[model samples]
Target: MTLTTALALGQTALKLGLICSLTVLALFLSYSMLNVCDLSTDGCFTLGAAVGAAVAICGHPFLSIFAAMLAGACSGFVTAFLQTKLGVESLLAGIIVNTGLYSINIAVMGGSSLLNMNKTTTVFSMMKEALSSTPFAAQTELIIGLIAVICVVAFLVFFLKTRLGLAIRATGNNADMVKSSSINPVFTTIVGLCIANSFTALSGCLLAQSQKSVDINIGQGMVTIALASLLIGGTVMGRGGILKRAVGMVLGAVIFRLVYTIALRFNMPAFMLKLVSSIIVVLAISGPYLKSQWPQIRRRLTHKKGGI
Candidate 1:
């Protein structure tokens, strides 16, 4: 590719990667920090998109962002209630909430599965207009995504260090110990999950505005993608502080989107794209394990050759 073509491709990947990285960071906070594997990510994400799109279409573009986040917080609250109060398993609670969010999302979209914002004023359009006269006008999406990611990473770095944050981390580490210390694990779990889901919803809101549309399946398979990205991030930045690990997650998301962009450039079929995502997930999950086993495998091969 020409230099210009390469630059454009990289920019597109960066834009998408930064946006999707929000979801990956949510996973970082929930799964890695809180030790809660939230499976309602897909529905929460879609719910955010649905709500954001509807609100933006109603001529309140900025309000849509907050509204979507509030919706996500509500979803997280429900999931946490099921797990903490109703004695439901975390995974099952997430699944139940996710299943219910489907109907709720539809209702938010006015009983439609698709929402077209072709003429609607979105946050992106507002940004585009504001940046129209600047030299950086063409980088509107990148700017917005970068700002959001930086804000989130900064928040996490600070949040993870506070007393409450430390307590939440401790709760994740040992609930019984936390209970003994008079820290309510249930409260921490609820707060952690609600915050994480809010980030997920923010991601969805940004993505919908950027695309100028919302589809019910916009968040399909998002959990798998985020999980894979988180694993990749952990591998890349193993044993780091909050800021370092957060940056790794963003890099992982960028790398994932880069691969996806390349796949599409190769004229791969749309159906096969899902397979590609699966393959990426598998590799991301297993790559470190295989690396760890390579030496033993090589030693066995050498022994067999020597015996022969």
Candidate 2:
């Protein structure tokens, strides 16, 4: 590729990676910290896009962000309620919420599958206009995404160190123990999921605005993508401080997006992208275990060679 082409590709990947990193961060909170595999992520993401787009189309660009987050928190609350109060299984609760959100998303989009913001003012456009006189005008999306990531990371770092955050973490580690310690596991679960899903919604909201369009299927397979990114981050950072791991999540997202962008550059069919994601997920999930077993496998191979 020419230098210009490479630069464009890198920029595309970085923008997308940063936006999607929010979802990865959400997964880091819900899946890793809470030990809850939330299957509702895809729907919740779409919910955010739909809600954000709807609000923005009504002439409230900035309000759209908060609206999307609030919508996602409601979705999370429903899922958490099912699991904690209704005695539903966490996975099943997520599945139910995801299934329901499809209809709700459609309603939010005025029963349409797509919403176009071609002429609507979005946060990106607002930023672009604000920076038009500066050299950063063309980098509005990047700047916004970077700011969002930094804010979320900082919030996570500080929040995880607070008392409630410690209780949430303990609940994830052992609910029974947390209950014994006088912490309400139910409350912690609800709060944790609400916060995590809000982040997921923010990611989707920014993505929709950046792309200037919202599609019903825009968030399809997002859970897989976020999980893959989270696993990649865990592998990269191993066990470390919250800030370290949080940074790893961003790095993982960028790396994953870079690989994805390269695959597209190779002229891979659009249909094959899902397979690429699946392959990457498998590799990320299994990499640590396979690395740990390498020595044993090598020893067995040497013994077999000697016997032969």
lDDT of each: 0.90, 0.93
> For every model in order, what is the number of clashing pairs?
0, 0
Task: Give candidate 2's error at residue 298 in angstroms.
Answer: 6.8
Over 4 Å off, model 2: 291-308
**So what's the TM-score on candidate 1?**
0.92
Candidates' TM-scores? 0.92, 0.94
Question: Which residue pairs come into collision in candidate 1?
Answer: none
lDDT of 1 by residue, 75-151 (tens): 98899989999999999999999999999999999999899998999888999999999998899999999999999
Taking the tens digit of each residue's C-alpha lDDT, what string does model 2 give over 2-76? 999999999988999999999999998999899999999999999999999999999999999999999999999
lDDT of 2 at 133: 100
Query: Candidate 2: TM-score?
Result: 0.94
Best model per TM-score: 2
